[model samples]
Target: MTLFEAERVEKVFPGVRALDGVNLSLEPGSVHALLGENGAGKSTLIKVITGLYRPDGGRLLLDGQQVSFGSPHESASAGIGVVHQERNLIPGFTVGENILLQQLPTSRGLVDRTAIRSEAARWLAELDLELDPDLPVTELSVAQAQLVEIAKALSIESRVLLLDEPTASITPSEAERLFRVVGKLKDQGCAVLFVSHKLEEVFEICDTVTVLRDGASVLEGGPLSDLTRDEVVDLMVGRVHEALVLPPRTVDTTAEPLLELSGLSTATGHDGVDLAVRPGEIVGLYGLVGAGRSELAKALLGLDRITAGEVRVRGAAVRIRNVRDALKNHKIGYVSENRKEEGVFLEQSVGRNIAVTVWDRLRAGIGRLPVLRYVPKRAEADLVSDYVEHLGIRIASPAQLAGTLSGGNQQKVSLAKWLAAQTEILIIDEPTVGIDVRTKDAFHTLIWDLAANGLAILLITSDLPEMITLADRVVVMRDHRVRGEVVNSRDYDTMSQRVIRLIHAEPAPAA
Candidate 1:
């Protein structure tokens, strides 16, 4: 039975038809996938279905009855729940409070604290999460927070559930756990809508898939088993995307290292780490979620205090006390993993955000009679326009807010900021997170292009395939310590197995 259906839905925004004649049907006990490239109306359809937006045409039907939801709350009250990609939890609230916020148990006209905690615990346990109910939401890691969000959504016991990029921030094990929970929900006859950029995950979890492209349904609902991955990709992007293969390394390995960390110990628990990236080399730091990959990146960027270690740039020792020092003195750039929080300023224009790092160079005059220093608008515009074109950033205009752009475009802006800074050594953390496959391929090409142009890049990521596809060398880390390093043979199976063994603390098999 069709539990929910969207009939000829149409949504229009200023100067953009976000969704045009989009139709969908969600049957009970099935996971329906919504697949598309970035800015292809997937989000618009989700908003329309979840009551964040009302369709301009057609109607929504639930259990064969016409219904209209005025707001998200109204939809939720009608047994619809959503787990957004971006976390929507109150940081200061406890786990129990956050999970039971919508419908807290009451005793004598008062919020029942014990009952709430117990109920929250049960829900979390159902998802195989063993978190403390009293723990604050802010104290949890990104993966944990995601799990809590899932628990919160599941706590409502809704018949129709919507999960947007649920596994984007989680580790493989955690993602498996989520898949199991989703399976349980499906077994219970719950209708699930799964949206993801990862095609492998979509194939693993979805029963049926609908592909949207350019605000229209290019491929209507069909069993995923009936379609090939290439066909799905073609429908999503309107073109066949070639498989990403790591190009031959052209870096001079004999040259002095651009950035080297020797016996690095950070106050944040990173200990005795050693790594190096020479000019024209892309070194990948491969690790699991808690393997200290991000922490090491922070230590290199001076965002976290390094208790003991020697950081060398071109064989010269330097103390990077802060991010500014790392950028200005050592010529090191960092693209943070948490792009939404640490990367581009969301409210600022795309041009301004890209030009921010080069403000000193943008100044027209320095050391003048009155010490006049003014930003040359023409020069800034030229530079921003060059990067915008070179990086293929999709934006209406340079004056548009960075937040208004799609995920892939925002990431390009972040890269443009560092490129404008002209840093010699770049530390990019999870550059492709939340980006579509086509954009990911473009980024991989761009990274190699930058490396070919003699830029040293330290790529920090939890994605093994991405590591193999771009890095010349892979440094495996586990528990804040460097396990081992391997040269990429471009063989995914061998490289992944070695990395997995190292991550699991298994001794490398005798050669």
Candidate 2:
């Protein structure tokens, strides 16, 4: 039986028709996939269904009865729960409080703490999470927070659940745990709408898929067995898709290292780590969750304290005080993995986001006054336009807010700032976590081109295929320490085997 349905939904924002005649249906006891490129109206449709936005045309139905939700709370009350890609948990709130925030139990007009803890614990155990109910949300890791959000959604006892990019930040094992929870939900007659750019995961668990293209449904409710990956790609892109083929480029191994970490130790538990990235080289850091790949990058950028180590740049030892010093003094730039937070400023204009790194250079002041310095609008505009055109960022206008643009475009804006800063060495963490295949290909090509132009890049990602596609050498990390390094042959079978072996290998004994 159909648990929920959207009939020819339409949503318009100003001049842009965000969604046009889109349709979706969720049947009980099945995982239905919602697939699309970034900005293809998937998020918009989700918002319309969850009551963050109301459809301008058509209507929604719950159990064949027409229904409209004025807000997310109303939707949740009606047994519809949604976990958006961006987390909504409040900082400093306990796990139990966050989970039951929608319907907190009260005693004599005061919040019932005991009831909240027990109720939240019951929901958390449903997903096999061993979390303390009183633990603050801020204390959780990214993956933990993601799972907690799902537990919060499930606490509403939703008959219909919408999960957006749930596995984007999680490790493979964590993802499998989520898949198991999804299996249990389906067995319990729950209808699930799963949204993700990871096609393999979608194919593994989804029964039916709906593909969106430019605010319209190109394919709706098609069985996964009936479609090939290529076919789905075509539906999402509206074209006969071609795989990205990068040109052969050679890196000079004899060249001096642009960035070198010798016996680096960080406060975040990294010990005796040694790594190097020479000019025009792409060195990948590949590992499982909690492997300290991103932590190492943070320490390099001075976000985290480096306890003991020698960081040499171009054969000279230097200490980076912060991201600013790394960018301006050392010509090093880092594109953070948490793009929504540390990357592009969502509320700012695209032009400003791209020009942020070069503001110091673009600024002009009165003849002898540094305090009165201001960025020349003309200069900023020119630079922003240059990178926008070069990076092929699709935006209605430069003034469009970064939040309004799609994930892929926002990422381009994030990387554009680094390039604009003329950074010789770049560290990109999980560059294509939740982006579509076509956009991922474009980004890979861009990275390849940058390296070809003599830019040194330190790439961090858990996607082995992505690592093989781009990195010339792969550095394996385990427990915040370097285990081994693999030279990329670009052959998935051989490279993946070596990487996996290194990941599961026993630790070396101390002398």
State each model's CA lDDT, in order: 0.87, 0.91
Model 1, span 391-443: residue lDDT tens: 99988889988876777788899999999999999999888877899999999
List where candidate 1 sits over 4 angstroms from the true fold.
Answer: 106-113, 365-372
Per-candidate TM equals: 0.94, 0.94
Estimate the TM-score for candidate 1: 0.94
User: Per-prediction count of colliding residue pairs?
Assistant: 0, 0
lDDT of 2 by residue, 374-460 (tens): 999999999999999999898888898998888888889999999999999999998987798899999999999999999999999
Best by TM-score: 2
Shift in Å, residue 365, candidate 2: 3.3
